[model samples]
Target: MASDPVTLNEFLTERLGAGGVVDDPNDLLRYITDWAGDHRGKPLLVARPRTTEEVAEIVAHCHCHGIPMVAQGGHTGLVGGAQPDAERPELVISLERLSRIREIDPLNFTISVDAGCVLQSVKDAAMEHDCDFPLSLGAQGSCQIGGNVSTNAGGLNVLRHGMMRQLVLGLEVVLPDGRVWNAMHALHKDNRGYDIKQLFIGAEGTLGIVTGAVLKLTPRAQATRTALVAVPDVAAALALYGQARRSCCDLLSAFELIPRACLELAFEAAPDLPDPFDTVYPVYVLLEVAASGSVDLDAMIEHLFEHGTTAGMVLDGVLAGSDAQAERLWQIRERMVEGQQLRGEHLRTDIALPISSLGDFFHTASRAMAARSPETMVIAYGHIGDGNLHFNLLPPADLDLAAKKTLLHDLEAALFSLVDDYHGSISAEHGIGRVKQTSFLNGLDATERELFEGIKALFDPDELMAAGRILPRTR
Candidate 1:
């Protein structure tokens, strides 16, 4: 077992101040549940540490007492990795108070910030310096850098800039044993023996608690263009995406594939938003291009539209004539999550396969889901430039919530099975926090599973850091 809850709470209050510990049931409820509202578990106490030293001290004390700790950042995680179980007598080390942007080196093109700093704040800081942070997501306003680093988050701009791992230059982490590993160097080339920072990038807080990070920045775009194109099907979408990639090359910032059902949901949920194209097609692609040097972005986009029209791949295309119009067009893509909520419960999957299998994967998975649960609505959308797709399944709008859940589970299983058949990863950009832990295990072989467990054991011998997350439990 573990230490007594009363004793642990007392110790936390004594070591840190009374303000650092929260034991009230009502206040602890928010920390217990995940963003998806799917996983729920009450924690014994919540610890809000404001400094790196405070985090280290708390983790050191917990390590000495053999108490499990779950590091929470933003709590916007889809996985239950942040969920703390009161029965298990775990402590939640919330990094909310550690929010701070330490420094911004315009000459070096880097920014050092505390892990609790929100993603949007970093982006704003980069903008002030006439640079860009590149890492972005739907939850940028709420999600913290620590969680992004832990998950190695990838977003729409990943096709051009890359994922969180590529942007991160250095990190400060508190290991499971409570030892502080400070490698906050912003150097481009270190030639170190073993890149220690890579170990915790996507480890999901199982190995350590990320306290801060040094992030790389890029030049801000001088001109940009966005478009909403109506394609006949996924085949046409892929072809258009290829042509745009060849024409725009590195300038092609994002290429998103949105199914007709998703667009309809957006229109239904958010009535204020207007659809750009007059005629609706079966599939639509939201594409964007940004460049630093002055280029005829309008003419380039016009050429793309004309080529797509002549090839019969694009039925109709609408280019953003103004910056406000560009933002409005982008809003349609950004509101995908909000629109998804208008439907019934959603069992979402983020998977990545080979680019060639993108069309086949969607067709096979959607067909399998429809056959498994005929009433479920399949809303498909995501970054098509890369192979990642957000395959979301919603229960029937007419059915009761309970009945819908029963059907949703069956549909999820069918979808995961098809993804496995295609050799696709179950959890792509989203880390296997708690929601997808079981599915990750189901998709992996015995040897691969063993390797993951071995790696976990090597980093966290006692497994006190975010237990039952990323790794499946052996009962």
Candidate 2:
């Protein structure tokens, strides 16, 4: 049987030390919520473990007593994957204290770090050795490597470097039984049987607790080009992307789509942010290309501009002249989320579809939004190159909280129905934490659910890890 709150608290304090155990409501407040402020939980206690051995001990104790637990790092996840269950007496195992750079193999082009190491710190460490870790995100400064790996994060650089799954070569995870599995090998080729490490990469901490990782790195970009090109519509943007890929090839780092509405909100949110052009076009494509060695990136970007203009895909554009100028152009993309926040209650859906289906989806979704809520504004944008769209809805701002939520819920159903029609994922880069659990499961086939459940049973038979997270707790 699971121990009582008092027993669990004493045991945690004994194992993790009094300083490591946070039962005080004030401190627990920080661990209870997520970065998006969308989900909150009531964890019995937050346990801060300083080492892998300490994590194992805590897990073993939990396993023995049938106590549920959730592994956390930075708590910057959009989905409620890391937050403890409000109903369960779950322990929040925060890995922040395990922050460390175990090794950096410059020649091998890899960096192994503790799960608690912040994403920006890992990037900085790689840069110190003249290497680059390309998993770039808006929350990189606060998000941890473990959480990024767990969610299989795809950020601005995903078009160039791929997601966290591609960058992570190996991992060190603490299983539910409290046994440590050290597969943290920085190997480029491991043709051995089934890749065991792949299981935990995007598992959302449902299967086990990730403690360390060996991540792949690339050479720092030596030459770069950035431009914000105004396109007539999604088709024009698509043509521009194709031209960019053919012209710049592997150097194409980011290709983001920003609608005029999103930009307007961005302007409202950050007035100091300069406009890229005088004429406000219908849509904008923020294109960035980088190379490690000698290559005429300037000519490549110039050719893209020339071709886009000739093809009538480019309406108006601005090519960044300097690093500062490039950063300024990128700021428009970065401030988009803040713009959504400024707009009040909004439904954010991270869905991915085939590149060709984007235009159809856009038009169809617009019609759907109009039919459902005529006053609701659709402010959509995302990494167009990867077919991921952050389809968002800003309903009538004057509605009260309850009314707003009801409208959002209805709008979400309408949009997701479109997502279903287009045969796209409801959750792309972001894992289906607590937010999309119902829809995610409803969409899954019986066989798929069975397989998932069997796998969960194999790794976490007790279902004590991350209760009611990706899947509901059987108990």
Q: Clash pairs of candidate 2?
A: none
Local error of candidate 2 at 44, Å?
0.6
Whole-model lDDT values for every prediction? 0.86, 0.90
Question: Model 2 over residues 1-475: C-alpha lDDT tens digits?
Answer: 5467788888878887888899889889899987778888988788999999999999999999988899999898888889888888689999999999999999999999999999999999999998999999889999999899889999998888999989999899999999999999999999999998998988999989999999999998888889999999988998888888888867999999999998888788889999988887999999899898999988888888888999999988899999999998888888878989877678888999988899889889989899988999998899989999999998897889899899999989888888988899898899888999988998899999999999999999889898688887778
**Where is model 1 more than 4 Å wrong at Cα?**
398-402
Please tell me which predicted candidate would have the highest TM-score against the true structure: 2
Error (Å) of candidate 2 at residue 344 is: 2.3
Candidate 1: clashing residue pairs, number: 1
Q: After superposition, how far is residue 74 of candidate 1 from its true place, in Å?
A: 0.7
Write one digit per residue (lDDT tens) for candidate 1, span 208-324: 999999999988888889899999999899999889988875699999999888877777877889988777689999999998888888888888988989998889888888999
Provide TM-scores for the models: 0.96, 0.98
